[model samples]
Target chain A: MKAPRRGLAALAPFLWLGVFFAFPFLLVAKLSLSDTALAMPPYAPQIDWSKGLAGLAAFVRALDFETYARLVSDRLYISAYLSSLRFAAIGTGILLIVGYPIAYGMARCPPAARRALVMAVILPFWTSFLIRIYAWIAILKPEGLLNAALRALGLPALDILDTDVAVYVGLVYAYLPFMVLPLYAVLERQDHSLLEAAADLGCGPTEAFWRVTFPLSLPGVGAGALLCFIPMVGEFVIPDLLGGSKTLMLGKTIWTEFFANRDWPAASAVAIVLLATLVIPIVLYQRQQARILEAGR
Target chain B: MKRGPSFFNLASVVLGLAFLYLPIVLPVIYSFNASRLVTVWGGFSTRWYAALFQDEQMLDAVGVTLRVGFVSATLATLLGTFAAVALTRSGRFPGRTLFSGMIYAPLVMPEVILGLSLLLLFVAFGLPRGVWTVTVAHATMTLCYAAVVVQARLVGFDRTLEEAALDLGRTPLQAFLEVTLPNIAPAVAAAWMLAFTLSLDDLVIASFTSGPGSTTLPMRIYSQVRLGVSPEINAVSTLLIGLVATGVIAAYLVQQRRRATA
Candidate 1:
């Protein structure tokens, strides 16, 4: 009775996941296999024995290294990929630089003020995301607040809109919270005695932080970097809003292919490649998490 | 321990907060600016807010977004709570690693990939793109967040109370209902609110799955901003900012009161 009841409970979540999550991916996999034109109503599941394999053959033909070759050869795709990497890397770096002090302060704050400090960090998130990005437009445009302020201060008005810099600023602004939260989570849980010990060993304040605090915060840093970097790589809204029409990112390319070109197969092909690229880091993170869990046990 | 106040730390914190707040504050301030151009403040007025109230498309989008958020948040919370309870209560199981991975996958998957894949899935399955599709996608993503928060609460939960209730002749269901439910109610409530906010703020998946009539508030805002940032968007954003602040403050106060009592 106990075993069956346990088994039933365990099976419930998997069933839910299989139906909702796994089924969608499987459908995508199937769609990627069959010819797009033939995938309509009265859907054919039959396969020719002479064709050797069903989905496999379809997948092989669709896998046409052509798309991959195109992605590599095209200057647009190559440049976009490189720019996306640069944006993600630069954004992550900026977030770490900006977030570290805030996280450190919050972690060290008095109990009464800690929650309030954290609240401030999370306060911007309350507004709709698109609205927040829109706010940047009000600030970053040529005639926007930023340039107006610069002109008022007797400085040359810097035209930031539609620039890579604007995209980076927006990406960092949006993702800073993700970086801070994880860093704060790890930092707040740290023992202060370790820092004190370092200080007592004749280490200066900065030295203490470098030697003791930074190493201990690596997990949070890694988690934060991963969180910010992963999504920022494929970020659509920021680049779309701030980068203007001329900027080409993989996300914009994918969107145009699906909505503009109506090339569903090619779009799926791009998506599959993007998905495969993301899966590598994710698998590594999962393995790391598993190892951590194992060590804890 | 005897170190003086660190002005460097203070300066950095101040700068970080300024960077985060300036854009948010500028829009709120400009919502009242009488000028058509966002760069200049001719005079302070509530005219844009008045205009926002009159926009039919904006109002319709808000209604659609609210409906989607409500249904998705409630359903996701329920499902997440069930999964959390099952995972926590059942000591060990086969494929546990796989189960955990499935739950976390949505949290990490890029919205672009998830959105495109779901779009393909909908097309393949012959499901019409609409509010229902958007809700399903939002719930799938937000459920993972709800699970993580509730699971955090469960990991620290004392299970002996449930065991005692069972020993006192309560059925397993009664024990769970009477004992476990009361204990974790706060986390469940928090999970629901978080899920709701997430569903409300979502744009990418909503953009992918929503049809003509199902455009959400964020989708509408994106469309408007894609053209140019209008004063009306500032007014709407100001109102949204107020709503979120009020909700967050209320949650904070309630949590504080509960902590005080405890």
Candidate 2:
């Protein structure tokens, strides 16, 4: 109950997060500027703490921007960034088309049915995310179930696996719940009387929806879009498992640089660039979320 | 509840539910197929399930996964609850914006960067990448999810109960433990489950942070699926589904019972 103790309690989380979360960014930022080397820890020049702060300053000054310059010169990184944005944008668009109706339908369900419906929606989402994505491989691969079904139906077999289409399918499938849940939360809180009021003012049903319901759900749309888009932009597993070498995703490129080429500094530079691209949407998302939280209270 | 055409809403809900469940159901059904090929259904058999149990690598991965989930989730919940409490109760402070930014950033941070950065940090600290390292990495990541869940619950909470406790001469920590905790227990429990599920399902971060003895179940599954699917994957997926279903139903029943009593 004491003021000093409360301050310390609040300080505890700040300290924990600062050390674990913010400190990593600092390390990555430093690593991003370092040169790749064939030494023990793989990237150089080390902090050289034994030489003290002056030595640290010298090492920091020695760090080059070549890795960053490589990202600009190499068309691969640019295409990868563009391709990631395209996939994520396409994924978000499809999610809106698919998720909007589902959330709206659930919102319109009878109260007794709505709870059960919400539970059902959450059930699959609660299950393993990777397993769900894995399930798609069986349905989309050449010798997979989709082909088998097509053969049963006397139709041509299609090979769409290891393509951007499969990656999009996987992205939309995996992230649909993320889109639906936020949309549902916002839609469920809408006041029905607003629509009735619109009708009373001589507005038609569809007209009333666009004028009132849709506007009211804008926050939900923003929230859902950001939730899906942000992760889709940096998605690694879907592109790796489902997309082709031609797909050109930043996430895959970064992963390959680190794991396959064993170039930590270059990967760090790419990651920082990715962070730069995402910074705007992230700030917007935070503001939108804060608005929603305020509205909730 | 209807605000529009009944047919449209009904069709949309049905289609969405079908799309969600069909993929899950196919895997479950194929998991029991006796045929070697996944597409064909020869007969019902437990052969794959038997094989899954017999596979030593899978067993080892399962052991590592369970340990990581238990340790990481528990730590994440404790720390996250502390964070949630601090965030919700504290009015505002000098560095609140920076603090909140750090808290929320990881929610949308890319897995690759997070993994790489954490790995670098571990390396910097001269820590070995094994079960303990995996535990620390997971706890740090999952704590954000737990904080978000608990924070949502705390937002709608009425502070009067805690105020009354304070008025009755209970210390802040004591009141928080006795009064606020019992009230927010549901959210806290949900946070724990979310944290555990995230840790269990993770592949990318664990791939970066794990060393010799810490190949998780998802990592094992990923490596296997690359080679190609066998009945073994279906069997494992089925087992995971069963586990999740049991937990969900149990939680649902408890919630319903609590609502009834309340």
Candidate 3:
């Protein structure tokens, strides 16, 4: 195929992405600058495109930093942002704790059992995310299975259903597959000879893991952390369902502003800041990914 | 591939698998519980399953969800296959970096932002939010997922078969249709399933975009769940879990059979 013609074959998808993905980001940006109104379509200083440049200029002139000012002046949004980051970081940390062993174990399984082991890891991933989160609620509620089992074991029945613990459970459960898959991908491809060499040098198994395997797996850790943390920052359902009254995550904040408060401009402004907060880590992730790919080549 | 890490690996696998499957299996088991409360097991009965069938609203949501999943998955697969082919074939083009970033960005972007932003876009265009809007939104999100999976397959594809087909006097389209398509069909099918699952599983995105008459199964479940966890939801969740588990196992069996034959 002719090069340009072949390139044009890509146009359809490019157009789809442009219209659907990039354009929405643009729309969000524009909406963030507008003011919230009590009217339908809900934002003020609506850009009337029919009036041409003058309309655009008028709209620009009408824009104010009032919504952003509200975001800063109110402690709620600020605390929400910080807490979202905290939740995401803690959730990611727990996922690493929970997922690394599983991935490492799967990676190290004997060749005969390896396929079934990996399949077991991935089976949960194919199930409905919402349903999975829902499944956890029944098990974590006040009179739930865990408490029942705890009582049976003659231990204090912990009440963690509406607490941060529950949210953490939800977040880790939801994002564990994301963490494990990347870790598994990296860990599976590792050279066994490196471990053998480390062992040959008189390092014990634990020492070998710490010195050789752990460092080699850092890329997977980073990738998995990035995968889990980025989405967890704006996670809605997990925190909403499991968190009950306690969790004030940024994603919940955005959802509340738009749906409950009917404050479009405020929601957009909050989203803009959340995006700004994420840009640094996201850029760093992209850079690291690129570097890793280059090194692999 | 393994030698002496026996005890450690075995313990980790058992604990991890238990953690992964317990919540899932419990929900399935409790779907048969005759108790009004979720935790207690009064007795085994299929009453919840019966209630699920009779619940008109839940049935409607199921219909809407399946329609959305089917339509969105098909569109996403079609668009995603083309995008994957282009990434593999067209080496580099203008805006290629931005193009790839867009493809990968959505894979990790928060569903909340993606949903809200797209809702705003729909409102800006004065489009009604309903079944089609939800479908479009879902397709947009899942297309990224589809592209990633299909791209991985295409990247490792052997090219000599297509070259041979071309050398045998087949035209480019003919070579692609006859050889390339067949080779990548498995990946494409896999992509479609992924897209379908993503669409079916979506709650945040669908909630933002769906209007009256377009309530999806997850949306219904979310609303019901917000009130309280009902036995009906457990039954529904069980069925969905069963569907997905069966699909995964069948795919594995197919792969294993292929490996054995080869």
Candidate 4:
């Protein structure tokens, strides 16, 4: 009796997730097999089981290695993908460089001061994301605050808006909190005795950090990197708003295909490809998280 | 380990904090600027806040957003708490691993992909996309967050209290109410708050599912920002920031007080 009741309870969420979330993913995969012409209102395609196999065959036939081939040769998609990767990579790098020290300082502070400092870091996040991005427009635009200050200082006015630099800046600014919070959490829990032990052995402050503290903080670094990198890879608003019309990235491409072209199949194809690319990093991060949790236990 | 105060650390912290706050601070400052040109700082005034209060579209969007958030957060929290209880306390079932993975997929999946897939599903079902659809979509996504928080709380809990109550001849339901509920109430509250915040913040999924008449506050803000910066947006953002900050602080203080008492 207990077993049955427990089984039913355990099964409840899975059933809900299967019906809602998993089912939609399967639907997308299934729809990807159907012909684009079959994508009309009451959007369910009439599936003949035999014809479904044929439709799958047709979908494979349409695979047009040309898309992937073009993806390689076509400078636009290739460059955009590269640029996005570059932006995410560099942005994550900068966040680490910038966020680590701050998180360390925060960790070293007294508990009350740490909480207040962390709250200050998080205060900006309370505002709408779009509004914060919009605020960046006022600061980064050609005639905006940054440029105005530059002009006043007798420096050349920089047109930072709609540039790759702006994209990097925007991404890093947006995601720094993700980096800081995780790093802070890890560092706060760190055993200060380890550092003292290293110091008693005549190790310098820098050497002590590298030898003892840094190695221990690797998990936090990994966690923070994953948090920053994964979302930045698929970021839409920053690229669209700050990168302007000139910058073409996967997120904007997928958005246009779904909304403007109304090609669900092609859009699904793009999403699948993006997901496939992201899966490796996500899997690695999950494994790391599991290890961390295991260690905590 | 008594290192002198490092200037490098101090300077970096100051710079990093400035970077985080600049955008927020600029908007707040601009909201009071009398000039329409966001780049120029004219004399300060409360005109933008006055204008924001008068904007019918902004008011309507806020109303719709609050309604959707309220419904979705409550539903997601309930479903999430149910799932958390089941998974943490119950026996294993077939496809238990698969079910766990599916529940978490929404949390990590790109919102764009989730939005696209849901939009297609709605179309496939011949369901009209609107406020109700948005609520369902938001609940689906926010449930994962609620589940994760509740699961974290459940991990530290001692289950023997409930078992002891059961052994004392109370029914399972009665034991749960009398023993388990009180212990995990904090987690439930945290889960609800998390779900509420997530539902309030969601834009992409809501964009896909909401109709013309059901535009959410974030959607409205996105459209406004797309054109250019506006003082009214600044006023609205400041208000939202104030509200969320207050809530977070209150929650933190309550948690601290509980910890002290415990």
Candidate 5:
């Protein structure tokens, strides 16, 4: 391609992301630094471009880190952040434990069964995420199906709805496909000869798996864990629908702050902090993707 | 040299699949309940589906969702195709790092952060939040997904086919149209489907960016769910699940056919 054409090709998405993707974060940061006002947009120091550089300077002068300070001082905000991290960490651990075996099973299946099994995992992913989480309510509520089933079986009814356990259930249900697919991809490509060699060396099947297969699948584990963990940290629907009101996830906090509280600056501040926590994972994911793409080439 | 699944492996797979499916299955089963109370099965009936179809608000939300999904998915596919091509084919350009970062970042960015930022941007720009605003937001978010999907196809693409087309005196665009486009059409189509579903599935961003009268299906369902899960919502979920499952199966069959032919 010609230089001008190449430049234009790059420029299209570049300009689009600049305006839509990248610029918005700057606006959020600016909003986060601004003081809340009892005004239309509910924040102050609006840039008056009509007054040119003077207005810009005045706007700059009006900005402060007060919202961040409030976020720090407020136990609610701190707990929300910590709770989000905690849920995500525990959820990731459970998903890994649950997902690894399933993925390993699929990877060991016959080629035909493997394809079918993969589709079984992906079909739910194709379904509406909101609907899937909502579905859990039917099974988890006090007078829900679980209790009905328990009654039929003459067992004690379990009350799990509107609790942390329900949130974990939702988290696990929603993110299991993400965890399984990547692990399966990595596991399916392992060299069978390595296992055969290990067997020849008198290693038990389990021992061979831990020493060979499991080590080989760590990249997939990292990819899957990060994929699930990053989103779970900011997950709104799962927690909102399945979690109790007392649940203090940052995503729900941001929503409540923005929509209910009408604290735009505070919401922006929470969002900024949420983004800050995710920067490392996001960067790591990007690098891993680049490496995968490079290796593909 | 392949070994069959062990008993442990078989058991875990069964239980995991059951866990993954039971929540969805319960709702689908309950959607057919004749009773108003969701827990009670008053025999088989489609009254909820009838109620769902007649509900004007539900129908309106569905209409809005379909329109948003179509428009945003198409826009995302175009921009995302451009992005994938540029990221994979073009060597480098100004602000490439930032550009690539923007492309990949949204894939995992928190929906709350994205939605709030875009809402602030719209507020700053004095643009009214409505269907178009929601559409734009969906396009921006989903384009990254589309890009990643299309990029995977593009990276493994045989560039020499396009090179050969260009060597045959075709213009760059012509070569792309004649050779590269057909090769990547399946991936592009898959990307569009993914983007559409994502747009269709989104609740958080739409909840943030949408104005009055621009409520998407997920938003409508969320509101209803918050009120309480009803038979009508169950019916809606079942229909949506059926629709998506159909699309996925059809695509899989087509892909299988294509692979066989190839």
Candidate 6:
């Protein structure tokens, strides 16, 4: 009952996050409601601090949903939002297909090799992500290494860079470890006896895997998918670097609106909508993670 | 019924690794190219490295990045350790749900949203967007990661050691400093490094939060990369890759050795 010191300890983090983390969203929301203006901060509805309360009332009255209205009316915003979702879905699927076998192989490795294999998967992740994505630019560019190698082998040059195909390739390459690590965690801990039981009962390797191993790895698959999909939806670097100017992803859309157009209100509106779209899945993922932690405890 | 890996599994592992590593290896290899053209390798040389070191703007950006990384990582570690301890130790305070939500939300929040929101907040407060602002933003973003790493270690921690120290006539702070600190040192170190790298590698958030004269190395590299690939950028990228790879492998090996000893 008398733990004031502990209470203070708790208050420090709470205060920091409340101010820095949670409060900013309110600012974004407020900015989204305001109109664009040619000003220092590039948003309208400025309060006249000379007449404090009256000024505040006028500012509140100035607020409207005009930016959100524009977002709905604009075809570009709608397509960007849809395109972001489509890219995320396709990227997640590709990552799952490409990552599952590698994770399975890593999980099934001899105990001595498993740690090293996990490190191999994680090593690229720890390296600079921007550099890795930039690396793809080097490989996929016209007349780059891929084409150079193709020409050496007497094959026609592949023009994959600056295309949607290139974007998917970059996503898969950059986020493969994210997809694999969780899958490996679940698969590595699975009991081998179930597979053996299936084998003894006349299940083939593929059948045993599909029924016993794959079913149990569903949690990991979900985890990995959400991990990759959530970020891919708002990913700017991958698309901007590889997807060319024609790709209309929401993240890039927001950047152009904010930086190039200096329309902070519009950018904030797009960001708010993006958050609204992602809120449910984010909460679900958090709950799942909490459950996993509880189960571990 | 023990069996070696099937051909499907083995082949996938090889191909997957090749896919993951070739992009990175190619850049590092080409960094030493003597030709000005990235595609054509005239011969092997360290001329790009020499050019990279002499570039003042690149050096300035590097200095800014290192300073930002160190400051933000330290701040995040300190605050995040407090957050982690608060989450794990302090049972059921008011606003606990909200506090915990803030911690986890950043991990899932898009960088663009985070960056934009913070920029607006700084603007509202009339704070100049510069190195310190970027540092604050990075700390805010990275604290969640730091808290998670520390919280994982804390969850598995045996509290009895600290309790014993407390029972032996030490104050709570003293017990924490002497017993808990040593026990969680590795996790704290790991968290700091994670935050540092997250700050270092960030481009999107820093782009929004940064101002003129505070361009980070990633932003600098990005501008050049957007224009086109250059040998100097390759040299810088290779250096970053080497530095990070060495640090991570060393940390991982230390962790493995600690696990073995324990």
Clash count for each candidate, listed in order shown: 0, 0, 0, 0, 0, 0
Per-residue C-alpha lDDT of model 3 across residues B1-262, encoded as one tens digit per residue: 2464478777988988888888889888999999977657799999999999999999999999999999999999999988887777766788777777777788878888999999998998899999999999999999988987887777677888988998999987788899999888889999999999999999999999999999999999999998888989989989999888788778778878987997
- Residue-level lDDT of model 3, residues A1-297, one tens digit each, is 656666564688899999999989988988888887879998899888899999999999998888899899999998999999999998898899989988888888777687777777777878888888888888888888888889899999888888899999888887888898889888888999998898888988799999999999988999999988988998899889888676799999999998999999999998988888888777767666546533532
Screening candidate 1 with a backbone cut-off below 3 angstroms (N, C-alpha, C), the clashing residue pairs are none
lDDT of 6 by residue, B1-262 (tens): 8666878888999899999888778778889989976678789999999999899999999999999999999999999998988777665677767777888889978899999989988998999999999999999999999999998988899988977997898987788789988989999999999999999999999999999999999999999988888878879989988899889879978988998999
For model 5, what is the alpha-carbon lDDT of residue B119? Answer: 94
Best lDDT among the predictions, by candidate number: 5
Model 4 TM-score relative to the real fold: 0.90
RMSD of each: 3.2, 1.6, 1.9, 3.3, 1.5, 1.7
Across residues A1-297, which tens digit of lDDT does each residue of candidate 6 receive? Answer: 235555445677778888888899999999999998888988898888999899999989999999999999999999999999999999999999999999999887898888888878878877788888888887888978889989999999999999999999998998899999999999999999898999999999889989999999999999999988998899899999999778889899999999999999999999999999999888887887767766644
* Cα lDDT, model 5, residue B69: 99
Candidate 6 has a DockQ of 0.68
Task: Please list all clashing residue pairs in model 2, or write none if there are none.
Answer: none
TM-score-superior candidate, 1 or 4: 1
TM-score of 6: 0.96
On residues A194-256, what C-alpha lDDT tens digit does candidate 5 reach at each position?
999999999998899899999999999999998999989999988888989998899999999
Q: Residues A28-145, candidate 2, lDDT per residue (tens digit)?
A: 8998999999996899998888889988898979898989998899998889999989999989999999999999999988888988988888889877887888888889989888
For candidate 4, lDDT tens digit of each residue in A71-110? 4676876676776677778889999988999998888777
- Candidate achieving the largest TM-score: 5
Ranking of candidates on DockQ, top first: 5, 6, 3, 2, 1, 4
Task: Tell me the spans in candidate 5 whose CA falls farther than 4 Å from its real position.
Answer: A1-7
lDDT tens digits, residues B1-262, model 4? 4543367766767888988988877777777889988766689889989999899999999999999988998988888887777657664666655656665556667788788778877876879888998998888898887887787777678877877898899987788788887888998888887787777777778888888899999999988987777778888988877777788889989989999999
Residue-pair clashes, model 6: 0
Interface RMSD of each: 2.7, 2.0, 2.1, 2.7, 1.5, 1.8
The parts of candidate 4 lying over 4 Å away from their true place are A34-75, A290-297, B3-5, B91-93, B252-262
State every prediction's TM-score relative to the real structure: 0.91, 0.97, 0.96, 0.90, 0.97, 0.96
Error of 4 at A98 (Å): 1.4
